[model samples]
Target: MQPFHPIPVSVLTGFLGSGKTTLLNRILKDPELRDTAVIINEFGDVGIDHLLVEQSSDGVIELSDGCLCCTVRGELVDTLADLIDRLQTGRIKSLSRVVIETTGLADPAPVLHAIMAHPVLMQNFRLDGVITAVDAVNGESTLDHHEEAVKQVAVADRIVLTKTDLVDPASREFALFTARLMQLNPGAPQISSHDEDAIAAKLFDCGLYDPSTKTADVARWLRDEAYHHRHDHVHDVNRHDARIQAFTLTHDAPIDPQALEMFIDLLRSSQGEQLLRMKGIVAVADRPEQPLVIHGVQSVFHPQVRLPAWPDDDRRTRLVLITRDLDESYVSRLFHAFTGVPQVDTPDRQALEGNPLAIPGYKS
Candidate 1:
């Protein structure tokens, strides 16, 4: 009736020849993904011939499984606007979700920025999750030489390891590749693309949405345990490659909403470029029962959402940050300064004078 509901948009990305097309083709065949609208960066990459595509008025094509496919011939904003217009006009009906498949050489941060920053698109769509495809046979080499490949894995909520059948399961190389992926992104769950059930279960509904009940799955989406578990494990020698790091910040006390706003604003203005991705569930002091859900990529942040109730008994404010060049101490110190929490050591007059903004107790 009203275009169904606010659609959850998922970003599917991978390096060149990482089997993104293969996975996409397979997903299109699934009846469960029937109500999805797919936006491919290039039309040539997808095969609409095999698909029983019903001709729509223009660019848009309806597949036999009841999905929609379109290409980004111009700007992404224009393409999305066109789709939303059609939905409202009753030309396209029963849209549940949308998937944007980015070019192999593309960086997903810009695409996310466009979606979150746009006024029209923001009203109709909510970013669900980022799913990245990695060729198990060549993922190691790709990460070694391509910064884009590293960022793709780092920002993903779920990683699909493709072409795993090409390598021996018991071989040392396969094991090493798996370990490397874990090191690079310990928070994201890794599943093989060959398993159709696993692919559907792990990838599609991984964001804040719970597909089984169509509700918010805040606890599962945050995945704070993945970062916590990695902390207790042995550190890899190559963990610090490319100045990329992942860490979690946890606080037992509730924080003032204004203070939280100031902290995030300062962080984004100062070191936003180094901030690859951030996600957290916070307990606001004024409303502890309704936790705030915040997520950001690079310099842009999505409008924070508040859940009706806490998903679990744990009410601690936990934030997981993945940064390219930022350090844990700097982020913690910055957060503490705005919250008026005492730092481990009081800054001496000379030290405070050197960098006045860093000290909460500093006075002009």
Candidate 2:
């Protein structure tokens, strides 16, 4: 069979403590997230969550050693550009889907701009969708105090209501307000983390790619099947915080094996603890003859499997991650490291495993 080349990337955004990480953790555990790639971007000078997520040696990104110094734009673009190069050049494993997590405090517009406008970055990557996180308990006050929080909610393709298990009855009004805010931007779907609210909604496949297109499909990364169910519940339900959020990211394409190995290695070293679960269907460049299916829990990755034939003729790749303490940027760096020049000198796999910057998980 011929090789497939094309990928779909997703952006996850939310306010501080909105359960963005938690929702991500839940996603990684899905049996269906095999052969996927995940990027988590947390705010502040240090990115500690990368150390906790479990990923394949070549499927994860962690540049800060322990934190993120990505406050500057150039650094951010350079990082994303590198990941793109790996994906486009066959240096890194061809990823079926790219999952990105943004810091709670991040102004998503700039990040979106990078995905849409940057020359090197734009050619290979696309804005799947903005997955925003809101705290069911404190989200109301957060919106009132943090303009960034409001903006996060304002532009979301899918909203994951985190900490639904802990929402107070008093926060009902604000929760409703958040729902109204989302109603204003109905293009995106909304789901919850921990609670089973989004099961019937279109929250499952929140990507930007059109299933009809081949290489140039633009789509949001995270797709939640519960999009419609959640909308119905919003009006009829009294409390919306009792459920947990989870979703999927799927695609068809061939990935580079070497780059994937490096990406997974980085995940073990930096973000195992924060990583909850991961799975994906990948298109390997070397094995363009066939596709690969990958799956894993924190540190424990399933061996890549060869499918009898492409799930579909399009042959896109799919990757889904459920996480905590991690975001899209944190994860993106792993993919970036494989494709670009390392900003800081990083230890090879041997040294990284022993270093404190690493998250200890299943090594092989």
Candidate 3:
């Protein structure tokens, strides 16, 4: 179903003790979200944000902060269905946007899939973007041990580094943590949670929408240039935990659509579990001006979005892949084979004895 006046929904996720709730409280106070409604896991924890608004008998609490807050009583679907119903009826007033705060331990992939895959929800709600909160103190350890924590960072469009106040500003620890985040996910823009004034502006308008023009913000949404030439060299700091690795592949020539599909299929089939996230803006050979935007989480992929025109001068097929326990050479070989391009090997890389793209054992 085509979205007719579809509402934008942003997912707020983070690891436990990452200060997700703290950031959410700050966002709730923003006047920009006056027309927005928030759905959180628990009411008691978030209720304090709206100290001025009296709690109603029903689950919904009208915040003097200008947004409505509700607890997820049961499944997420039920909560969303109820919101839609209220919007359709006269129960809710001026509801334009929605935000769902996932539990700290939650893996955000399923939450994104739920919003994008449901037929009813798709018609009324579209995924705006995902904002993940990363704790400055425990982020590295969390990402090192928990795959769930890695997924949260991998799939985010925007990352908010929280608890920076606890650490010294001049400390190398914060700087090091930022570097790890960049390595894990280079496409996302990181904002300091303490920068409260900039939070609403940076986090909102993150999706494909340009509120000023009411058109797709493809360039801003896909910031492909950020990944250009990044990850060219492996760093000891980022390589500490080899379990999760991120790499960007660029092609100057346009690609065949069929080949692109095949490459994704092969990768998913072989390393679907390890493939944490794949995001790209491909330039098609047939249509140079129009580009295909692709995003996937694990085995599930959101439908490809084709923009009306090229967002900028750079017209290369740039793809950023984040995987867990997956070899970079294996992924490089698959992409180059499908695109019909030559793969370059570095001097330090373990040369694949037989195959040019990868080692002999990589071919499955």
**Considering every candidate listed, which one attains the maximal TM-score?**
1
Q: Model 2, 17: alpha-carbon shift in Å? A: 1.2
What's the distance in Å from true for residue 109, model 3?
1.4
For candidate 3, report its TM-score.
0.84
Ranking by TM-score: 1, 3, 2
User: Which residue segments of model 2 deviate by more than 4 Å?
Assistant: 1-5, 42-74, 88-91, 168-175, 197-204, 207-364
Top of the candidates by lDDT? 1
Which residue pairs clash within candidate 3? none
Candidate 3 Cα errors over 4 Å, as ranges: 1-3, 47-58, 207-214, 231-240, 342-364
Error of 2 at 28 (Å): 2.2
Give the higher-lDDT candidate: 2 or 3. 3
For every model shown, the clashing-pair count is: 0, 128, 0
Q: lDDT by residue for model 2 over 1-364, one digit each (tens)?
A: 2344434556677887887656665564454444445565433322345544333234344322221122233466766665656556765544555666777788676666566555666455555556777887787667667767766664566677777676553576755765665443333555656655333133345433332342221123323233223362343222222111223443334557886777776675556544444555566788765666554545555445566455454566555554444554446434434534222345444443334244233232
Model 1 stretches with alpha carbons more than 4 Å out: 2-4, 196-198, 209-215, 231-240, 348-356, 359-364
Sort the predicted structures by lDDT, highest score first: 1, 3, 2
lDDT for residue 237 in candidate 3, whole number 0-100: 45
Candidate 1 lDDT, tens digit per residue, 1-364? Answer: 5324557889999999899989898877777787889999766887666885676756777888888889886899998888888888888877888999999998899988878878888788888889999999898888877889989998998999999889887998888778777767888988898885735656877657432344677666877887777733343445444477778888888889998998898788777898899888898999988888888988798888787777788989888898887767778766766565535475443453344365542212
Give the alpha-carbon lDDT of every model. Answer: 0.80, 0.52, 0.76
Query: What does the lDDT read for residue 282 in candidate 3?
Result: 87
